[model samples]
Structure formats: C-alpha cells, structure tokens
Target: MNEEKMLKVEKIRRGTVIDHIPVGRAFKVLKILRISTDPGVTVSVAIHVKSKKMGLKDVVKIEDRILDSSELNKIALIAEGGTITIVEDYSVIKKFVVKLPDIITGILKCSNARCVSNMESAIKPSFTLLSKNPLSIKCHYCEREMETDEIMDSIL
Candidate 1:
C-alpha cells in the first residue's frame, strides 16, 4: 500500500490545520489552544507521524475554529516552521508557515521572577527574538535569555 493510502485522517470542512508540528508537541499545541476544554470543538491529532519533510511530525486539525494572531504567535514559540492552513468548504483558503515576530509582547511570561515585567503590575512581559533555528529569546526587561524549552514553559 502507498503511504497516502495507509494514512487515515479525516478532513475538516472548515477550520485550521496545523501541520509539521515537531514530534510529541501536539499535546502542547492542544494545551495552548485549550481544545480539550471546549466541548463543542472537534480536534484530531496525529503524533509521531511519518513526514517526508520533517522525518517525524505531528498534525492537528481543529474543526470549526480559526486561529488568531496571538494564538499563532504562541504556536511559533514552540512549533516554529510548522504550517497553518485555513480550510473553507474543505478547500485550503490560506496556508502559511509560523514565523516568530521580532518583538513578542504579552504572550509569554519572563522566566525571571525579579524581572520588572513580573514585579511591576503595569508592565507586560516582552521578549526580543535573538535566534530562530534554535529558538533563543531575550527578555525585554531583565535581559534574561530563554531557549526553546524555557520559552515553551513560559507561554501564557
């Protein structure tokens, strides 16, 4: 049997499909998206799936929901290089890879407890993108650097 024939996942008529998620990260995607908490939303997840481009990857299909910019930003913090496809009437209307912004604000909490963003009530947490491939970021207020793991933990 062909690879396509062996794979069995249902299509969503309207919603967003997140593809190329790194292996074992689909649950994190679900956590960040709060998909399980919502009873009305239908979600399908495939983990450790064979991927020609990524070797092993995960795919998340969210039925009847489209992600917003903030959600995309959160996904980028963890699932960088993953692609988001918006489907309408079972057709892809838009597709794009997740890209981290130069400056990320209010989406992630600074790891440093002493950071001004954390201590001060008026300030919101912010970070500056330092690297992409390895995923490094620097806190705007504390100058503390965070890598992918820390970034993943700090998602708000």
Candidate 2:
C-alpha cells in the first residue's frame, strides 16, 4: 500500500491518540471515555483496520484533549495493549501503554446484582486487581471474582 493509502486518519496537531485497540472495540473505548458527553471535542474513530503488529485494530483520536490518569486506567481494562500518545505540534510528546490501577472504584459496577454496591445506598463499587494477563478483578464488597469479559457489561 502507498504511504498515503495506508494512513486512514489524519494526524492531529494536539490531543491524545489511543492506538492498538482490539478490532471492533473502538466504540467500547469511546463509551468508557464518555465521548458522547463531550460534543465539543473533535474525535475520530477508525475500526477494523489492519495493523502491522496487532493484526486488525481500532484507533481513537481526540483533538485538543488529554485524558486524565483515571480515564486512562479505565481504558486499560478493555484495551490491554493500547497505547496512549500525547500529540503536540503534530509530534508525539508522550507515549505509553495504559496501566491498570491497584484498586478500581466507581469506574465499573460490581457484577453481582445483589452486591451492596448495587443497592440504593451511597456505596460505590470497588475492586481489587487480581491478575492482568487474563484480566481479573475481585469485588471488594461481594468478594466475587470477575473476568475481563464479564466486566464489560458491568461498566458504569
């Protein structure tokens, strides 16, 4: 493919670029980022695209916005190998893979429906990271272990 043909999306002068998202998961990333609420920000999403290293991958570009560390942590749950690139003046100022936090709270709801976190109280869901390879978390209240896939539906 020609260089121009290989480039599916235009470069951003400034903002954050999330790369190497698994194929068909770009929208999930957007949902986790709450992109729909930010109508003013310029965002680009490319899905089901070929990647040299990741095979088929998805990418998300947000113009003039840098995600907070907590936001990045939420992304790590779904996009394990995803890289975050901070762009400035059309150059990458920083780049790193999303890292999972030691403890995750309020970002996702507990899988157990009867868990205290799901009740009509002020209690918020909390989880402790148990593993990263296959991605697992244990609910702090219910002590229920959840795999990565199960966590998707429980996302708040």
Candidate 3:
C-alpha cells in the first residue's frame, strides 16, 4: 500500500461527515452550517480531492454535531448528490444521499425583492423544485424562477 495514494482524514468519535460535495462548495457548506463561527467544534475539510465517483469532490467532517432535517434540506439544495454519514463511538452508523424536497419553505428566500415572502414577515418563503439537473426553483408567491446561482445567493 502506497501512503501517498491513501486519503487520510482523521475519524471523529461522534459527529457528521458530509461527503461528495461538488468541488469548491465545501466552504459554502461550512458557511451554511455555521461551523466556523462555533469555535468549540472540531472540523476537518478536504477540498478538490480525487474521487472515483465524482471525479473531484470535497468532504467535511464535523465533530460533536449531527445534522437535523432542516440542515439536511439546506445541504441538499447545494449538494444534490452528496452523502451524509453519521458517526458514533468512532463507528459508522447511518449513511444516506441527500435528496431535495418537492416543496421547500422558509429555507430559501425568493430572489424577487417584491415577492410577498420578502415584503411580509408574516409569510414564509415558499418554492417548488422546478428541476434538479440544472437546479431551478420557482417561487410560489412571485412565480419567479431561480437557477443555481440565484438559489445559492437566496439561501436564508
């Protein structure tokens, strides 16, 4: 076994491992999870690593934190094919691929400034998944369509 060929990310005793993030999106994932702001949490990030399945990918290992459904939903929007792994006692427990929901609410703000969700605090932003390949979404209120870049900016 060649040491240079091996990918050696240290294992976490208990936490979450987000793998297969699209290249250059690991920072975005970190920002979304606010991992950097929490000084006490231990985090390891590998960017643009060679991967057989994704060609090139990013990985994030966060110590002492398990993602909730809302956090997973947010991750799914950015990392469509990424997988989440749960670790406990230095052992793999649960693993699954991220899946976008049909209808997402409050997680993303509509790009349209005049949209009712933005105009009225009482109304939560709502959007329906338009397409996954190109990553498009339609705002339920303004009926405006947002593509990948727009969606990335609109995350609340």
> lDDT of all the models against the reference?
0.89, 0.86, 0.89
Of the two candidates 1 and 2, the one with more favorable TM-score, higher being better, is 1
Residue-level lDDT for 144 in candidate 2: 97
Candidate 1 worst ten-residue window by lDDT: 1-10
Per-residue lDDT, model 2, residue 126, is: 88
Candidate 1: the clashing residue pairs are none
lDDT by residue for model 2 over 1-156, one digit each (tens)?
622365434889999989888888899988888899988899988888788787789989999899997788788899987999999999989999887787998788988889888895788788999998788999999999999789988887
Model 2 scores what on Cα lDDT?
0.86
Off by over 4 Å in 1: 1-9
Report RMSD (Å) for each prediction in the order shown. Answer: 1.8, 2.6, 2.2
How does each model score on TM-score? 0.92, 0.84, 0.92
**In angstroms, how far off is 122's CA in candidate 2?**
5.6
How would you encode candidate 3's per-residue C-alpha lDDT over 86-110 as one tens digit per residue?
A: 9999888999999999999878899
Score candidate 3 by lDDT: 0.89
Clashing pairs in 2: none
